[model samples]
Target chain A: MDRKELEAKIIELVAISYGKDEGEVTLETSFKNDLQGASVQMVALVSEIENELDAMIALQDASVCETVKDLVDAVEAEM
Target chain B: MNILDELFAKAKEDPQKVAFPEATNEKMMQAAYETGRDGYIVPVLVGDGPALKALAEERGYDPAVFTIVDVADEQYRDEVIAKYVALPDTRLKEKALARRMQDPLYYAMVMQKVGEADVTFAGIDNTTGDVLLAGQMIIGLKPGISTISSIGLCDIPGWNGSEGTLLAVGDSAVCTNPNAEQLASIAISACDTVHELLGWEPRCAMVCYSTLGSGAGELIDKVTEALKIANELRPDLAIDGEFQLDAAIVPAVAAKKVKRESKVAGRANVVIWPDLNVGNVAVKLIQQFGHADAYGPMLQGFNSIVCDCSRGAPVSEIKGNVVISAVRAAGQKK
Candidate 1:
């Protein structure tokens, strides 16, 4: 997937996991600070992303992905 | 059988009813379901009912199987507030009481206090301090007990210390820098845990760097004084110490270091550390390096049974903790 497509997908997963609107999640939206996503939810989000994209995202890498853009970049790197 | 198996059996026998305030988490809900299905507990999920139901369905569990109590309901909120206000020795202001009525932790405690539930198991999403505070404020302490303490039940393989490889380490996850009196209370609480949960005769050791006054310092003095207080509190229990860890556990070390012919010296299953620094570090070392399966830091000294789980705990660990709490509740009833 292209970078824009990957970023959109990441925002969608974060939005769904945190029960937020897709329009509310942006590239700079932090999983924890902005969305109030907990560690368990973050794990679930990563799993969902990996499953949807069929890409391997290491938990360590996912943990450091603070924002939606970071998560997209990590997913792009894995792809 | 291991300690978990023993507790599971006891839980099945009487099936203590339990409440979980933080039931929104999928892991906790799953464990609650499993424990309920296995006849270990009648699990009551205290939270927003619809949200919990949605989460349960999302996690592939049938919400009908669980008793989800909505704290936000008007009737439930009023009932909890009335119970909280009517509780003896409750010093919470009306504002605080109203706020607490909205908190699921306080609601769970209210359920336990009013015989609506047998025990409360929380701390999956909350901190240990939060759980303890809710427990202390709502449930109150046991009679004559002033301090709240914790005990970690360590199952060390090939180590025949207390009732096989099972041992209890106290004040590890609570009581930061307890005085002699608080330390004594911790020991007594740990002994009660061993007796209640494990069904074992507690042989307690007031562990320190010294082996019966072998070392000289304020720390050794603290352990010695705590041991005296513990003995005075429970004369029947086999309690002794101010011993080193080896002297407390290993018979050979006790023989060489401890001259007294005390029953607890060499065969202590419950070892009370001097402080949190020692107790927490020692338990973690045993868990990581010694490869011991540590079950708790199970909060003790409360009138009702309430346990706190690590935020990162897995479903299996939560299930084990629930069983342990159930055993405690069953014992308290007796």
Candidate 2:
């Protein structure tokens, strides 16, 4: 719904996708560099985020958002 | 039983568990279902769960009949990532693991590497280069084997020879212009595969434009040197060459052209071409003009069982290749 909530949800999805603890995922944690998410995983992660937030997030736009905070910002902008 | 029948019988005895990373394709799904149903293999489909289930349902096949490994799920993702991290020479760490986990092929390879599955089959959705790269990077290479090659199992209608008359063309889909050493490795790998698949001791001929020293060129020299290297490396194998195609396969021609005695002369089942250009052209010519039944371009020399099928391969060919891969896996365990 909001920036904090979206960021938390994004972080949670990342953590779940990677099987990492929620505490390990941070705002600056990059999906590729930090989470080691491949292209398909990134798509899955973005899809999960969009479904949870019930918003239309462009895959192209989401793909460019490298970090969790960037994804949160993208979601907030769309909202 | 025929060669394929025997292979299927052997595979069905203890069907090797096979993982398909690109199981969403309709042909691939059909092949997987048929092979599993026929007891040739136990198919493990790796991909998104809902998508795979939906595809199976659309195809009138029950998804519950298949062992589906959903890489997107947390449990399967974590397990595959952990197995990958533990692999020898794995570059995938925590960050990279996330992305690699999303790849069905990578997950299938990890399953093979960890002994969860006996073999992995893909390349319908990916290229041969991609499948081989995943195999080499994840499943790793066989011990002391530096090169991974491909062998096209050719079955010519009227060409009669030993061991069901199956001929193998090497480096058909893998190496480009291998040096002498690499050529020797390809020859050896081809011999090993022919032996495993056809249950016959392979008489390998390193084919060239020249028969022995009759012709002169850098290519001929490479083939001759490859023969010498192969002999030194594997003295027990019946390998000889730098022979013309006729001298390699036709006994009458061998008797005329080959002045010296050789085991593989005129009776060779395994023919190693000088380069990919020749190998590719030769196999295709045989398949098209000669109306030969060509089975593979099967990937060889990997430690684990990984096979590549042609893009848009039919269901029957896919099932046959799976049996071939399973037979190889069974032989390797022995």
Candidate 3:
């Protein structure tokens, strides 16, 4: 999946992932600080990313990640 | 011909160390009395000694052929309950108080708990709730187990059309709305149980509407979580899910639909259902409507003792439950 498509899919998962109202999450929105996504949600996101794009990003590496852009970059590198 | 015969054979080869519950009913009595050729002669724990003697006499059960423990006397009752509550593994007072509110089934569980018997089978006339309550109150679930269930061995006649396969379906009678994590735990536990009962290292499938993430919903989410956790728990276990039945069991369909290269797909011998309601209905339909013979939905994850039985089950079925429980106890000890 391309970056734009990938970003959109990530948002969809994030909204459900955080149980937030759709369209509320933005690219710069901090997953932990602003969205309240738990550790389980991050793991789930990593799995979803792997399945969707057939790539793996170290969940440990992702744990230190703070923004949606960080995830996109991780996905890009893994892709 | 079945694993049951093999297990009974094993039990007979070691009869004194062989501790099996006494046949409380005529059918079980007949099975136990007539159960020869299998190595072990099991000990029977009957509620009423005189009643059992009367029935044995009526049924022509050689009073010499079996050893029976009459648990009806008050002293015996207190002794049994005290022993059950005293076990390092059992929480005695809580269980005693809980079971004191009930009758015979609770008493029966205490007998098993105190090592008066190796495996205890009750509930021929009792409800699932009754059997389970006795187990939970007296025997309690194994240390980490948060729930209980029934996993039946269903042999669908014929293979490729004539030699049918045997499958294990679980939580058919227990665990409602199991979360993603619980579902994963159930799958792993069921796989172990399948190995113990059927003598096969089972391929597990977490059944869902979706095939390879094609279907989406809360149910899919649960199955997906189970898949991830199963990988983590038993990395070597062959398991997969979030698939339709066709893809889960049929090789051709699975090859076309399921994306993961999983050993479990199209070859799974164990099926984990989403909820007890669905599982109970599915297994029942397969047994009653499809003419498949089922043997459990046995309790798992309990501590030292196990208590389980069918609702108004025949004697043969109850005997099988005992054998399975004994085998499980033996398996856990290892």
Candidate 1 segments exceeding 4 Å error: A1-79, B80-84, B93-95
Give all candidates' CA lDDT scores.
0.82, 0.80, 0.65
TM-score of chain A of 1: 0.89
What DockQ number belongs to candidate 3?
A: 0.01
**B1-334 per-residue lDDT for model 2 (tens digits):** 5567878888888788889989999889999988888778888999998899888888998665689888878876677667766777543454544655578887788778878998999989988766866676567666656577889888777779654556888888888878787888898888888777766788999998999789998989999898888899889999998899999989999999999989999898888999999988998899898788887878888886799998977888888998899888877786
lDDT of 3 at A62: 75
Q: Model 2, stretches more than 4 Å misplaced?
A: A1-79, B87-94, B259-261
What does candidate 1's lDDT look like per residue over B102-193, in tens digits?
A: 78887888788878899999988888867876776677776656588899988888777646787889888878888887888888888888
Candidate achieving higher TM-score, 1 or 3: 1
Q: Of the true interface contacts, what fraction does each candidate have? A: 0.00, 0.00, 0.00
Model 2 quality (TM-score): 0.76
Which candidate do you rate higher for lDDT, 2 or 3? Answer: 2
Better of 2 and 3 by DockQ: 2
Chain B global fold similarity (TM-score) for predicted model 1 against the true chain B: 0.92
Better of 2 and 3 by TM-score: 2
lDDT of predicted model 1: 0.82
Give the docking tier of candidate 3: incorrect
